[model samples]
Target: MDLSMDPAYSITKSECVELCAGIRGEPYSVSVLKEGYCTAQSDGTFRADGTISLITGPRAVLVDTGGPWDRELLLSKLKEKDLTPAGVSVVVGTHGHSDHIGNLNLFPGATLIVGCDVSEGDRYLPNQLAEGQPYLIDDHVSVIPTPGHTGRDVSVLVKGTSAGTVLVAGDLFECCADEDSWRDLSENPELQEVGRQKALMDADVIIPGHGRLFRVHRTPLN
Candidate 1:
């Protein structure tokens, strides 16, 4: 079904703030190990950093490892939670961007899902994300293809959280207040717009790829 066509709800963006404070819920507590940032240089260059998040639930899931520069910081954050690299059962990279999956080497035992591909070690597990199916990690966690930022981008959706449903949306949204800027960064603005609309309709809160956690305000379509 085309979720974008659902006419029951209207999605709107509001409230962008750094998640220096994490959100906790039953079975899953989300912690932002690092908040992503994008900066334009004086020259014609740009610097970008990816956000790193840890999802503690029935299974330990680490989302977006950040770039190589974040290796030590990643390790330190895990240690603060009394978790070791091996303790993470799954590692998800919303897309294959270097800034997002750079530290994947740290978790050799993890089940890796970068974009729509799922794998364990050298063996790849098949899934239907490309065909628009959501992969369920469990009843409360799912990896859904959000595409457009990249041809195969995906986002992790966690339900039953303290803040209601949280979509760890990668660049599916560059930031909460991205209405004016996302098109410039998107690979397929049209498709991404559909996905974004669906996301806003479904999530109560969103963890954007490069900023903070924001609330999704929904207005019922009569």
Candidate 2:
């Protein structure tokens, strides 16, 4: 099947973990933080904000903190799981949207990893440093520039776990299972496709900006 031509290429939900596991490799155990959709009232309406937390070695890295709507709820959930805000050593946003970055202020001490396109002029909270290119938070975890949903869009990848590689795709796919949600990716189909290709190649576990976690078959497109 020409998966690219298929709209399912945009968003299709299956037991990705199981599917990827069958591909002769370990699949990462993923936890979907928030799962739902949001609407944008203006020209820049980016929806599907959520969070993904990955335990890479001794450090815990967070990918994209959801919106103010779920900030308190998310915080409660983190606390319940015994994951304190202060304990997070790395906090990364897929992009600099208000929704994705709403709760960023909660993690004051974590290194703020962002894309090269994101400028210091950007409205980040105090004590946050904007970085460029792919950054390694640890020996096993890194944040890569995906840049499609927005100029600042990024994806987080965690390696060296039994669960394989997990890609926390903030707004990159927005639940690659919903057809209507494809419009939320970006108007530029080419960029969105590039982001899709990146996700497919880099991640075994595909964690969307919103919705439950799934696994992806990493095909070497190059």
Candidate 3:
């Protein structure tokens, strides 16, 4: 069934509150390496970039490395965390977009998870992301498939966080105020809408692909 044409999905956008929120958890602390942005240039072109984040814990995970232009900044941020490219145990590219995974070469030694593909060098690690299953990283973190903006998008769900559950969602949400913009940029708006609704339901805080962290405020049941 195509949910895009369904009335049930008519108001799928969540009630969100944009804020500079911090999501800290035991064994894992989430930090935004770079808050992404998209702006119109003087020309017809657009200046767009994806968000980058560091999830520090027993196994350090880097989410969305930003574009190649952010290499220096990415390195600087890692140094601030007392980490080098080698310190990152895993690099997750939420999708195949250049703005999201351009700097992946910086972490050659790290396990690469691009969409549903989990690989280490030439060897691929099999998982069930394509089957709607989440790949658990530990007791607190898991990478769940949430395809929408692209056919293979995924998000990192960090449980037991200071802000409850923090989802490092890629373009699953263009931004907190993206209700009028996401569908235009999505490859499959229907699927993306489903993913967005699920994220809003499951996470208390969401780190979007091109904006600051936002809190999801669900209406209480009567």
Candidate 4:
């Protein structure tokens, strides 16, 4: 369980920003605000409208945008932080949930990055598939694709001496302990395995989309 030795432990230099409601113990600084709620899915899952800002080098990246109710709040928060939608280098929607893509229209200058199965012509405008591909957000950081939650979901991984390797799990591991919530991989096995492997891998820090940030404790896995 030596995370440092994990293949996923590779590093690259970059600026980082967490734009969601503040996670309790995460490394990046965040601006917190009560946003809106996403529409309920047929499965009855509901997501709150909160976001995190990750700034790397001279570019700023927004993880997920809160819902319509908080679009103004997001804009205000960005203003408070001296960030403008026009200044954003990229927008990473963890998944296609309304809560995550609400303010996507705000970033006219940014290239929208989603999972491989996502359609570029979809509502998220200017969408592109991640496909586990690496995007250089300058010489410092990259947005690595790790789809699971939804067919097109992806996460952001930041690299820096101060941060080491940080994984923005999106919904990949909704919370720090969600790795154990799975029963078997038979249902959508590939996604389950991907999520499991990511959780088992070592990361200096894990930034979940909804819950607080946490450090992983090593657990032996077969």
**Model 2 regions more than 4 Å off:** 1-13, 16-30, 38-48, 52-56, 117-132, 179-184, 218-222
lDDT leaderboard ranking = 1, 3, 2, 4
Which residue pairs in model 3 clash with each other? none
Error of 2 at 3 (Å): 3.9
Candidate 3 lDDT score relative to the true structure: 0.85
Evaluation by TM-score, superior candidate among 3 and 4: 3
TM-score of each: 0.93, 0.71, 0.90, 0.67
lDDT of each: 0.87, 0.61, 0.85, 0.56
With a 3 Å backbone cut-off (N, CA, C), the pairs that clash in candidate 2 are: 11-176, 11-177, 12-176, 16-215, 17-215, 27-163, 28-163
Query: Model 1 reaches what TM-score against the true structure?
Result: 0.93
Error of 4 at 32 (Å): 7.1
Which of the numbered candidates is closest to the native, going by highest TM-score?
1
- Residue-level lDDT of model 3, residues 173-218, one tens digit each, is 8777786588989989888888887777778788999987787765
**lDDT by residue (tens digit), candidate 4, 1-222:** 122335434422121244243433223332334322234477877545544545434566677776666678788877876777787777777777776677778876677775543323354533244445666655545566665556556667665524345676666655554444432312354664565466546455666665555555444344
The true-versus-predicted C-alpha distance at residue 66 of model 4, in Å, is: 1.9
What order do you get sorting by TM-score, best first? 1, 3, 2, 4
- Please tell me which predicted candidate would have the highest lDDT against the true structure: 1
Stretches off by above 4 angstroms in model 1 are 1-10, 16-19
